[model samples]
Target: MSNLSDIIEGFIKELLEANSQRAIEIQRNILAQQFDCSPSQINYVLTTRFGNDKGYMVESRRGGGGYIRILKVSTSIEEELKNFLNESIGDSVTLNKALDLISALRERKIITDREQRIMQSILGDRALKGVVYEDRNKIRADVLKEMILASAENDM
Candidate 1:
């Protein structure tokens, strides 16, 4: 058996896979019991492992009869990559937002973990040293656009 968090993640993924729509709903209390963990543990897995960057949408209710719903969005990675180029990112992007884009690509399975790390290394502040803030952001934007385009091309 794997770690508790991994086991819980696997179980939820199994349920999602077994369904036709790639979605699933469950009571947090029930899931916690099944995993022999606290309800918070279940929440931790859901938030960190199944974040938006991970290509999941989560909804939940607070009280009794409340349920947690996980929906796997059907989106094209290339489209999102383009959107970033055309909209989200301006001439420059903040480090945090840049990393978010990378994480989203990884979550979408458009890029591998190695790719994410490589992008971060090449686009991080250190790589833009001596450049003014404005120019650095512009450089970051260009680099990210090129990388995303290359990745999208490879996918096609």
Candidate 2:
């Protein structure tokens, strides 16, 4: 049998799939009670499995009527890529963020699996080992930005 976290994740994903908007809001206490676990456990599954890298955004309100809002990223590939380039990334991007961007691109079929592996390899920590800690993110961001722009130009 799957663990509680997996079960919870599956349940939430099912909800998202069932909704046309691909978004859902659930009260933490209500969900916890339904799952027979603590609210913190639900939070753990959310943070680890539904992060931007995994292609989901989670927003939570804390209070007596707190609700967790989960949104699956937009499916329009071109618009999504533009948003990422203009807003999600800036002068510097962490390795995880870069990986997330790459993963999203792969998920959307914007980039092939081979391209995904190549981009990941090029932008990974090992590839940046020679750079100073302070400069790694900046270099990664620059490389990613250029790669995306180049890909866009080629597609045109």
Candidate 3:
């Protein structure tokens, strides 16, 4: 059986595909009624799946007219590449943090599976193992940034 989060994500994806510009107005009462789940469950899905790092912006209005609005942030391939390059610069990203950032990009459909795999390989601890780990990491970051920037430029 699929989990509630997966189901909700699929539903939201379908809705987005059908109308890319449309903002979903989720009401706890209405979603709970449809899914036969608690209102809090609805909240959980929104909080976890519709986060900014995942390229979604969520807003809610309270009271009788209370509704949740989820807006998908659409960025060009160039924009995403640029952002990734900018972030990777001048920083020593830990393995866990790097994974998290990659996961977020994957969730937003900005990076392909192959790209992610390559990125992992390049950023893996094994690749940076040595007395010069810090230097290796900095070099890796620079290389990754250059790759992204080059890809972005190609897309233009």
C-alpha lDDT score of every prediction, in listed order: 0.83, 0.86, 0.71
Candidate 3 residue 112 C-alpha distance from true site, Å:
3.1
Task: Encode model 2's per-residue lDDT on 1-156: one tens digit a residue.
Answer: 999998999999999999999899999999999999999999999998787756789999999988999999875556666777877678999999888888767766677898889889999889889999899999999999888776666554
TM-score for candidate 3, please give it: 0.69
Task: Name the lDDT of candidate 1.
Answer: 0.83
Task: Rank by lDDT, highest first.
Answer: 2, 1, 3
Look at candidate 1 and tell me the lDDT of residue 96. Answer: 78
**TM-score of model 1 relative to the true fold?**
0.68
Residues 24-107 of candidate 3: C-alpha lDDT, one tens digit per residue: 777777877888888888889888777765667899887887988888877787675666556544455666656666677666
Better of 1 and 2 by TM-score: 2
Candidate 1's C-alpha runs over 4 A off are: 1-3, 82-104, 112-114, 124-142, 154-156
In terms of TM-score, which candidate is strongest? 2
Kindly report the root-mean-square deviation of model 2 from the true structure over all alpha carbons: 3.3
